[model samples]
Target: MAARLPALRHRDFRALWIGSACSSISLWTLLLGNAWIVYKLSDSSLWVGVSTFASMSPYLVAPLGGMVADRAERRILVRVTRLATFGVTITLTLLALANVIEVWMVVSLAFVQGIIRSVEIPSDQALLANVVPISDLGNAVALTSTTQHGSRAAGPLLAGPLLATIGVEGAYGISALFALLAFASVRRVSVSSRGGVTRLRDVGENMREGMVYIGRTPEVAAIFILVFAHCSLTMSFDAMLPGFAETRLHSPSGGFTIMTFGVGVGALVGTFVLAMTTGARRGPLLLGTALASGISPMLMAGSHHVPHAAVGAILMGSSQAMFMALSAVLLQEVVPDHIRGRVMSLYLMSAGGVMAFMNLGFGAMADRTGAPILFFLPGAAFVVITLASIATGPYLRRIYRTGTAVAVAPAA
Candidate 1:
């Protein structure tokens, strides 16, 4: 336990972690509120996907966000984004209290929120790496990933009861409070290195340089491709959980909470395991767990009982966290500090932007073909992709073979 939590000893990293956790909590709450409200308003599964898409579309421009992360003062950037989130939540609360909230209004606000997220995602990630040393990066990444998936687990649980009693307006009101907490916590982070100093006029040149860097690095490029494929095919299916809960489980608002709870618990377990795992040789662990994650969806698709689905969620959540957490660690270790923000932005683009479109498509398909088929197809594809990548990508294998591949930066 002590070894896994070395990063906490650093004051700046500790502050950043708490702030990030609050941010994660707020983000998850916002997602739950949006999903439930949209589902209730339209009574159509497609609208749920559309609302998610509206909130995630900013991922498409994540490179620009990465550019800002690399060049701008990341601490201020994060605080500003949290304030934007606070504004969104407070406004939604007001509209809900007024009883004038419409479906279009919800979708429009979500779109605006997505724009803010594009900047927040990259800045937060970059700032995390900036605060921690190279040796503790893995633990830091695992813990941060926990903050996200763990919040997903807790957010809906809180939302379910709130929805049952005070309704969506009450939920948004709580989310507003969380957003304020996030803003306060982030204001405490103080990093020695703010990031690269680049002018706005050089934005085009900086972007081109970032692109060329990825193009020249095969191992890094492979990781990005895997990240994109993993998100678009496997992860995006999560957006359909509300529909699955209603149609498959036949449960009310509480169903989403149950499903997400299973995922969150599984992810927390995964974080613990990864945090304990030191040194390199994480290649097999990453690939093997991802394979398990992809295959678990089969169980989820076939589940008729709530417990069965929960078990599947646990398996999927743990494996998925291993895959993503390792990817974040490797990206941080391998990429130079100057371009790390831009590089990580590409990752966000895959995991966020591409996944948003996939959700939209999956939502439309679920309406026609049903959720079971949607789940099964993606699960099968995810398995196939992991297997194919392992067999063919010799470069990736070579990178993992060197047990201590973590690169150390020179002391300031």
Candidate 2:
């Protein structure tokens, strides 16, 4: 805790972390509320899948988003995005309260919100570099990851009760309030003048450069591959789980939401553990944790009851958080500042894109072979890849060290 506490000592980083956590809570709350509304309205899993695709497919614009992030003031971007998110959530809540919210309208609004998130996500990532000193980047990244997981865990748990007590509209209204607070926090952070000219062409060219950079570097390439493999197999489970809990497990609609909360709790714990460790080497531990995270979902697939599934979800959440946080720290330490946004965007694009395709495919597959197979197959695949990654950990570490040395040599 002491090691982790140092990162919070910095005023800007502290504000960023607090604001980001609040926003994360709002985001998850909105997700739960939106899913509940869609499920209740349409009574179709396919519609849920479509809505999710609408919400997430905006990762395709990530390269452009990254370019904008590098050019714009990140603090301002954060503030604007939070305000927009607040507005969107409030509008949706009103619609729900008025009993006039249509499924298609919800889906359309989700897509619009996704567009804002595409810009916001990259800017948020790039902003940490600006707000924190370079020496504290790793710590800041860790703290940020921990805060995200903490909010994720808290949001779903809070959403369940709020939705149960006050209805989905109230849950959404609460999320809007959280978003407003997040906006206020972002407004307080002063943006550093790391300004660069906004070049639209640079979006494409910079994306190409980022791709080339990753292609030329074995470590970066490996990270991208690992992310694709893990996220594609494991992350899609969230989209499919609602249907699984509803039909296969014969649990109430809220059961799936509770499962999400379990994962969030696991993730929060994992992030805290990662943050507390000092001088942590980022290779073998990360790979091992990723493998563990990937394999945990199989347990859920085989579970005969909701409690069993909840345990599996918790493990999956924790491991996923550890994998993501450690990988982020590693990337931040290695990539050059000039192209960090583009490079990280490529990673995000790969992860998000793969997860999206996986969600569609898994949803369709669950419809066919049933939910159990959907969980078993992907979970097993993750375990296999985890082992493979561990075997190659030393080689990957060497590659990362070499590439980082070369990237920093010119600056030196």
Q: List the residue pairs that clash in candidate 2.
A: none
Model 1 weakest lDDT span, ten residues long: 403-412
What ranges in model 1 sit over 4 Å off? 399-412
For all predicted structures, in order, the TM-scores are: 0.95, 0.93
lDDT of 1 by residue, 1-412 (tens): 6655898877888888888878877877778888888888888789988998998888899889888898888989999999999999999999989989988998899999888989998889888888888788777877787777667676766676887788899778878888899899888888844556377568777777677777777777777888888888777765688888888898757677787778877887886677677665577777777688688887789977688888988887888877888888777777777777777887888788888999999988888888888778888898998888868887666545643333433212
Each prediction's RMSD to truth: 2.5, 2.6
Q: For candidate 1, give the lDDT of residue 353.
A: 89
Q: TM-score winner among the candidates?
A: 1
lDDT of 2 at 342: 71
- Identify the leading candidate in terms of lDDT: 1
lDDT of 1 at 230: 81
lDDT of each: 0.80, 0.76
